[model samples]
Target: MGKTIAIANQKGGVGKTTTAINLAASFAVLEYKTLLIDADPQANSTTGLGFDLRNIQQSIYDCMINEGQAADVVLGTEMEYLKLLPSHIDLVGAELELINHPNRENVLKKIIAPVKDQYDFIIVDCSPSLGLITVNALTAADSVIIPVQCEFFALEGLGKLLNTIKIVQSHLNTDLEIEGILMTMYDGRLRLSNQVVNEVRQHFEDMVFNVLIHRNTRLGEAPSFGKPAILYDPDSNGSVNYLNLAREILQKNDATKITNQEKILAASDEQRDT
Candidate 1:
């Protein structure tokens, strides 16, 4: 199965959905089957991919609450290889409902299991909070990609995030790993942005990705029209950066091929044994 990652941060306006949608677009461009999970109630990731939010028949809430069938909620996006499991505003209440369930933390994990082997990657755009929804995302994910916006108070909410990850690792899912911490909306012209970048790198060190996404107008504009920067303005710096991120993802996963193969074999054996 391909790696499943949650693009998460408790702090809002840090571009978590932006990164999730664009990254999924990037993966689709590489001919990889990518499923974008809109775990957030805002459903920005769903609209950002050009899916009409108003006319949805089935939503992620239906699947999350066990009211609707899974995978049937998938909507075809403008991109050929990208599919979106759209969310609705009702997802805001899903956390409270999920909390009472036996596998509250792993609600999403169980939902994703049946179709985990179908895609090359599954990217979840988590809500900007440390609530049950975020924990659900963390529990389901194989890895977490943090999108840290370069600005003041950037690290203010991170301690809580790390603690939540730790809690999930210990009690919810042990295989969860930090895939890469990305620095987004970087403005080299601003000293503060650079400072945030440096400070974060000092703490994360090699765990931080080498790539840094600079602020670009096209990046901000694409979502307004419901398109990824790649298709909206393919030549823009933001588009290039996301494409580069896909290449980075491929390279990193390629280096870990042996481990992935072992996982596939193990999964196969488990199926046979069952």
Candidate 2:
């Protein structure tokens, strides 16, 4: 089965959606089946990939509410292995609608379970809130990846998010773990950027990846042009960084596979000896 990861953070302008779009595209380029699930009401990830939001008759909102099946709502893009679950304004009302439902936090998990094995990676771009919608996203994810911007208040909102994760692990989803913390909007020339990086590393240590996403115009411009940085400007620094992040993800997946294989072989040997 594929790994379902939520690229989430409660802070806006932290590159969560951008990371989701670009990373999904990058993974597709690497020959992996990838799905980008837009749970954000704004539908930025959907539009960024050139989808007309109004025309996407069904989206994640409908899937969660049982108005439609999850697989039926997946929209194809030009990329061979990349698909999108588009979002729309209807998503804005989901929090209020889902409040009274039984096992409310699990709605998304149930909706996505049937299709989990169809993709190599499922990336959910969560809304910038700790509300019910985001709770649903967190509840459904196997791992959470936080994108921290390299700014003065970089660590400010992290505590609340960490607390939420603690609650989810203790109550709702015990098996969910932090995938990694990504440092975004890095400005190599600024001393404050370095300071922010040092402070985050002090708290997260090796949990942060070495590849930092520098503040590049192409990253910001691509969305307006309705394309990923990779498709917008293949040689841009933003494109290069996201591609490296994709490589990091695959490397981790490969390591996990090797570890599992070793465990299986050892188990077989034990069975034969018995």
Candidate 3:
């Protein structure tokens, strides 16, 4: 089965949507069959990937509310290996609508379960809230990638997010893990930025990604043009950082698979010798 990762942060302006769009695009460029799901009502991920919200006929809201199949709402993006489950503004009402529904937490999980095996990676862009929609995304994902801004108030509200993850792990998804903590909008020249980075590294240690996403004008401009930074300006710092992040993720997963296989082989050899 494919791995489902949620790009989540309950804080706005943290580069969550940017990471989701560019990272998913980077995975596609690397030849992985990837699917990007826009779970945020803002629909930024949908538009960032070059889809016009006004023209969307079917979206994730339909699948979540009207009993529509997730596959039916999947749309082809410009990238060959990248697909998108577009979101609509109507998703804002999902939280209230699902209040009385049974198993609302797992609704998104059930909707995407049927197509989970079809892609190498599925990326969910969560809204900036710890509401039911975000809970559903967490319940559906195998792991979460948090994009934190390198600012003075960066660590603010982090405890709540960690607590939410712990709650989901204990009740909703036992296998859920924190993929990595990404530091975005970094400026090496600024002392405050450097201090924030050092503080985060000191706290999270190896959980923080080594590749920092530097503040770049092109990164900010790419979404407005409806394209990923890599596609918009391949040589930009934003594109380079995201590409490095993708490489790190792939290497980490590959190492894990190798370790698991080695353990299995060692077990088999021990049984034979006995």
RMSD of each candidate?
8.7, 8.1, 8.1
Global lDDT scores for all candidate models? 0.87, 0.88, 0.92
What is the lDDT for 175 in model 3? 98
By descending lDDT, how would the candidates be arranged?
3, 2, 1
Q: Which of the two, 2 or 3, has more TM-score?
A: 3
Candidate 3 residue lDDT tens string, 1-274: 8899999899999999999999998788777789999999999999998888999999999999998998889999888889999999999999999999989999999999999999989999999999999999999999999999999899888889999999999999999999999999999999999999999999999999999999999999999999999999988999978977987898888823333433554477589899
Off by over 4 Å in 1: 255-274
Q: Evaluate residue 79 in candidate 1 and report its C-alpha lDDT on the 0 to 100 scale.
A: 88
- TM per candidate comes to 0.91, 0.91, 0.92
Query: Across residues 152-259, which tens digit of lDDT does each residue of candidate 1 receive?
Result: 888878888988899999998999999899999998999999899999999989888888888999999998899999899988889878877877877887734333
TM-score of 3: 0.92
* Model 3 RMSD, rounded to 1 decimal: 8.1
